[model samples]
Target: MQPSGILETALYVTDVEAAAQFYGGLLGLEVILRAGDESVFFRCGSGVLILFNANKLKDRPKGGLPIPSHGATGPGHVCFSATRDEIASWKSHLEVHGVAIESEFDWPNGAHSLYFRDPSGNSIEFAEPKLWNLQ
Candidate 1:
């Protein structure tokens, strides 16, 4: 059997509050939940974006649900689907907010993509669905 699709995407950050500001305040994602300074969850389209402070995982409160500890160190990458128009808008919005655009280009398939880094240095991308031949 094959899994249907992704339901969550996780990105490790140094500070939940700063990450929250970037994802929530800048990107306009809806804040769904917050777990003290350890983690924060945001609703992104049909999926959830989870930001976790890896440094605090070892000290997380014990014995509630026995969830396995999970996190990644160093920089990670994540991409959001965007239309051409939306990408253009995003470029302007990001520049206005002082979020440097690391790279922006057209793929061989003619799809467009833009990249940037979050506060924690995680690579963030916005690309046209056509980049993957998606409709």
Candidate 2:
């Protein structure tokens, strides 16, 4: 298996620009790619956040927002790893935005994590994984 690792996470949003502002302005992500009225990609460490124009999908005759089928099947969450200090800051940042904290944990090695969701209800987290490989 070629575990090259995940490259990005695509999430649906009502407003792409607003999502960018929340993620980029407040969360310190950098917009790496943006095609007006289509999609915008934000950089978070080695990963990317892909946000699409919600209305554009609606304007199309064939495709609307993607929903789970008969049961939860495919994509679920997009986690961003952060340093210990960064995790603390992220916890406060999300709190200030009135974002609900779904959970928090202190790992065995003392690394920490906080889970929450975006405006579109996609579950996301800022974590400090104790065992991450550079390779």
Candidate 3:
């Protein structure tokens, strides 16, 4: 059987507070949990977005849970679903918050996408669901 959907998405950041400010304060994602300086969890619709401190998790002691050690370097990417109106609004909102829009364009399918970066330099995007022919 195939997995239904993603429950969580993660991105590694150098600083957790900066991530919290960007994702929670700027993007308006509700802060669900905070794990000291290691990670921050945000509620993004039905799913969760987690930002982990890249340096902190590198030597994490695996004692309590079966979760394995994981980390990533450089910039990662995540795209959120948004309609045309919402995408346009997001462009203005982000700019007012000093977030520079890296690119804004239409795909071959005519779906519009707006791209920016998070505090950790991870590529963030807002695109129409039709980008993948989804509703």
| Each model's lDDT | 0.94, 0.72, 0.94
Q: For this target, which candidate reaches the highest TM-score against the unseen true structure?
A: 3
Clashes of 2: 0
lDDT of 2 by residue, 2-118 (tens): 978678777767667777777778777888898785678988767788877666655555455564322122224777878778878888888898878999888676667788877
Candidate 3 C-alpha lDDT tens digits along 1-135: 998889999999999999999999989999999999999999898999999999998878769888978878899999999999999999999999999999999999999999999988999999999999998
- Model 2 whole-model lDDT (C-alpha atoms): 0.72
lDDT of 2 at 131: 31
Q: What is the C-alpha RMSD, rounded to one decimal, of candidate 2? A: 5.1
Report the CA-based lDDT of candidate 3 relative to the real structure. 0.94
TM-score of 1: 0.95
TM-score of each: 0.95, 0.70, 0.97
| Candidate 1, poorest ten consecutive residues by summed lDDT | 57-66
> After best superposition, candidate 3 residue 38: deviation in angstroms?
0.5
Summarize candidate 1's per-residue lDDT along 88-110 as a digit string, tens digits.
99999999999999999999999
How far residue 74's Cα lies from its native spot in candidate 1, in Å, is 1.1
Clashes within 3 Å, all models in order: 0, 0, 0
Instruction: Sort the candidates on lDDT, descending order.
Output: 3, 1, 2
**Relative to the unseen true structure, what is the C-alpha lDDT of residue 18 in candidate 3, on a scale of 0 to 100?**
92
